[model samples]
Target: MPIDQLVTLLENESIREALMIVYERSDGGTEELEWRDVRDALSSEQWGTLIEQEVLVSAGSGFAIAEPGRVERLLGGDDPSEDAGTDGIESPSWTTADKAAGAFALLLFAGYWNTGIRDIVASVESAIFGPVAGLVPFHLVIVFLAVVTGFYSTVLQSRLLDREKLEQYKQRMTDLQERTAAAKERGDEEALERLQEERMAAAGDQLGMFKLQFRPMVWIMLLTIPVFLWLRWKVRGGHLGTGETGLVVPIAGAVTWQQSLVGPMQTWLVWYFCCSMAARQLIQKVFGLRTGTSS
Candidate 1:
């Protein structure tokens, strides 16, 4: 729909409903106008400068606005979690090798992301001319980046491992918006279809987030390879006393190949336990996640 029609609807539509309409019309499946963004996009004069901006359409005490990045993220743009919610936890549901492959892929991602260190180093290369005082070597750079990545990934995986419930919450919010919009349009039996769309979309996304994020090997458990590397190099080596060079050799070695799962339980479950249990607990604690009722 044109921005003008959106504004006409925005005048009377609830903010959430307006957002849903925008999401529906958008090429991709998401929206960039978070509540905070809307607030920021508007002026402080209460409802004063709204329509004048052409970005937002003020409705009956509520509104909608044009969002710049709606399609990108909805279509799987930047947020890693976008796919993480759908594609799965680093590994597929099927094979043992899946997890291992995921670990390698993730590490590769880390390496690739850090490849720019070369540019960073080359920029400084002309400034440093000694054999040992050389600009950061590519291998050393990769290792350094990997180690940092591993630490962050491990922590992130653990955090998201149990996000199943949180995703549901997002789904519900989305659904509620859609249903209310249908009530407005009263578009016929098809309106019921709209409600169905709301229910399914919300439920599916919540389930997807839950399944992917809560998986043991996908999230915090992702730390395994990184953790193992750290353990092999730093924790068990007792080289902290040796300082910088001590860390250097270990990080350099990271260039070599590496390897697992974190189980839900501490024992018997093996590595799978590492992340599974964390995911379960996360879902339980953050109880308010989406659980859209089927219409």
Candidate 2:
């Protein structure tokens, strides 16, 4: 602790980043701290008997100090040199597993919808070829799965990016704190310098970030619609389901590839969802990311 600066209150948790912010005073210099180690620094001094006997100084509220550090171990370590193709490790944004799972589940729902849509065709063809009619049922299922898969694939990626945004917000809060602290310690002039320092840093950071956007080049997302349609066709053979068959495909375009596919798709979605939950857990465990229900 600088003789001029003393620790103040701690800010609440933000998404993803490990670093947290703490309030402290300094001799008018910048004291911005973006860290995740605040909890370790915070302490209660209510039970000090030895110092209690003497006259207490009005030194404001005394508490444990906080530090600036990362909350997550993303391994990239502020590095800009790396292959874009993330093989074994999931891209914190998108994963093949997530794409596969969502695609399959949506396929099943599409099949169900297709089944009902082509019921009339099924009934018409049932007399001639019962087995062949069944083929049409599968297409509906595949289409549903494909649509859902694509939608959720993007959803997952968006969420991951959202975490990054929150992390930036948390960093900003920290910078603001440090500037405020410097102002407290150095009166008006030095505080202005601290604020200017923060502005320059932020301006520079923004320029670099503009080039790292993850859109307009990921071909996988564009491939989803056609893939979904193809799957539907493959499952149904040729016939598309209709809305008349309330029992099979309650909705229009009820796909009916195989009743069994539904189970697998549902299971896969559950698993992918679990993956996101696991990511949250990992962040919390490693970088001390706090949750809504907890501190």
Candidate 3:
């Protein structure tokens, strides 16, 4: 359904004032207006709303009124009696699928400590990897698993995350910080107090950011845990015959897969992580995959 443009423009006092400012500065919609022209008169929220609502459209160097005739008509009419509530930061909610995946991931995590779960997962996975294990050394199998997991993990994160929304959250926080610092420098207690209130409200955005970061991790874990359990079973269940268990690693020289190299971390786990990190980095560079927020 189309937005009730008149209601949207007239409902919020800040948006109405900002629209008037833009109209005057743009010479009654004949010209375009840039942020610098009205930055002092309008807040970031107001400016964001104008762009989001499609009231201001991209016009070369800046923005112009999307529908000058409709804006003129709305401005000339009586104000809306019901004032709109203040807009809060909209945090993304997890879908039912995401929750389900997270639950399964947690259950899979228990396989690391529980021998019953570990054995079951390993037995199931052996049917798939047993043929390959027969052809290559166990260390090569670890390398192959690491590379496969790394590729999918990187792709999943790039596809699942909302870079634009994360950027918006960052921009809002940066704007607030800059304004707060300026208010402090000028010793404006009133502006400082107001910015503090805005900061408190924005605290929820941090949790939202965390949620966005962790959503992909749940899926990654769900896929990775089974592989890990299978590897653990292979190492501990005496599946490795004679020389297959030993691997030569950097600094540590020759070490058995079961040998503890770093604190409680065994040789296989350490080797797996090193291979995974290198493969993930190489895959990202080769494919131009982005996992971090854009600048």
Candidate 4:
């Protein structure tokens, strides 16, 4: 039975009194309740109504509350259906550090299009990475950056994301969907309507889920954008020598770092992307880190 109907049933004075009597006599619904046991307090009509509504189903010899825990909760004045999906899950709030990181990440993102910001970031980053670049070819430098970014990205996601809470949120929605389907199959319009209302109320969970997934991205962008700027500076500022400017990649064979492999994506960016993906997968496998909720 839907909680709404159970609530409605409790509104009747006679039904409420009868339920109280039955609950008390049955030891909080631990034992079966026969009509004869509460005959003095409950009227025939109330007993018949309880049976008709299926609130009490036949046990081995007598009737018992169909769902004792639900009945107990309702009687205790708690509404289980209120905030169905967000019952135990707290809303994710961004801390001051998180907000600061996001703000800084946004500022860094401007370097991608603004030449002055790009040069400043590249100049600052080159002081740190330039020595490494001087030793290895530019392609190897790109691979090294990819591995570093991939490792940190995975670690940030694992630490920042609340995997258990995410799983709970998903499981609650899945359970609601299954209940909705069952109600539809049974042609229970009242139950279906209640489930639909619950589903609508749970819609705010989508935003909560989004916040959970995006919390780590700000940190990632803050760390990654500077390395990208440095790579761009190296290519455009004639930092790469004759042999370091090109690479023999898998599909494209030999291609210059600045050559366009995809629609606006340069060869270097493509290679970095491929390397980042492979490195991320390997890191996750080796460390048993999970960035997403399990099925």
What's each prediction's TM-score? Answer: 0.24, 0.28, 0.70, 0.73
In model 4, the Cα lDDT at residue 228 comes to 85
Per-residue lDDT of 167 in model 3? 78
When sorted by lDDT, best at the front, the candidate numbers are 4, 3, 1, 2
lDDT of 2 by residue, 1-295 (tens): 1111211111222211112222222111123221232334532232121123111111233322221121111212432111111121122334685456555545444543576534543344345444543555433343344445544444444443434543454455465566456344434454356456545545534433332233311333434433433433433454435531212334323333333324555322333344445544555556554332124
lDDT of 3 at 81: 26
Alpha carbon lDDT of each predicted model: 0.39, 0.35, 0.79, 0.81
Top candidate by lDDT: 4
lDDT of 1 by residue, 1-295 (tens): 2323434444543533434444544322222233344354333443333334434443333344323232233323344343222232232142465467566547633532354532343334324322322345423433443444444544555543435444445544554565456344433343355445645544555555455644545544344444333323322233222322322123233111112112222111222233444544454345433222221
Q: Estimate candidate 3's alpha-carbon lDDT, on a 0 to 1 scale.
A: 0.79
Better of 2 and 3 by TM-score: 3
Model 4: per-residue Cα lDDT over 133-205, one tens digit each: 8898888899999999999999998889888877867866776776666455445566567677877878878
- Which candidate, 2 or 3, has the higher lDDT? 3
Report model 3's TM-score to 2 decimal places: 0.70
Following a full C-alpha superposition, what root-mean-square deviation does model 3 have from the true structure?
10.1
Error of 1 at 55 (Å): 29
Q: Which regions of candidate 1 deviate over 4 angstroms? A: 1-96, 99-176, 181-204, 212-224, 227-237, 241-295
Enumerate clash totals for all models, in the order shown.
28, 49, 0, 0
Highest-TM-score candidate: 4
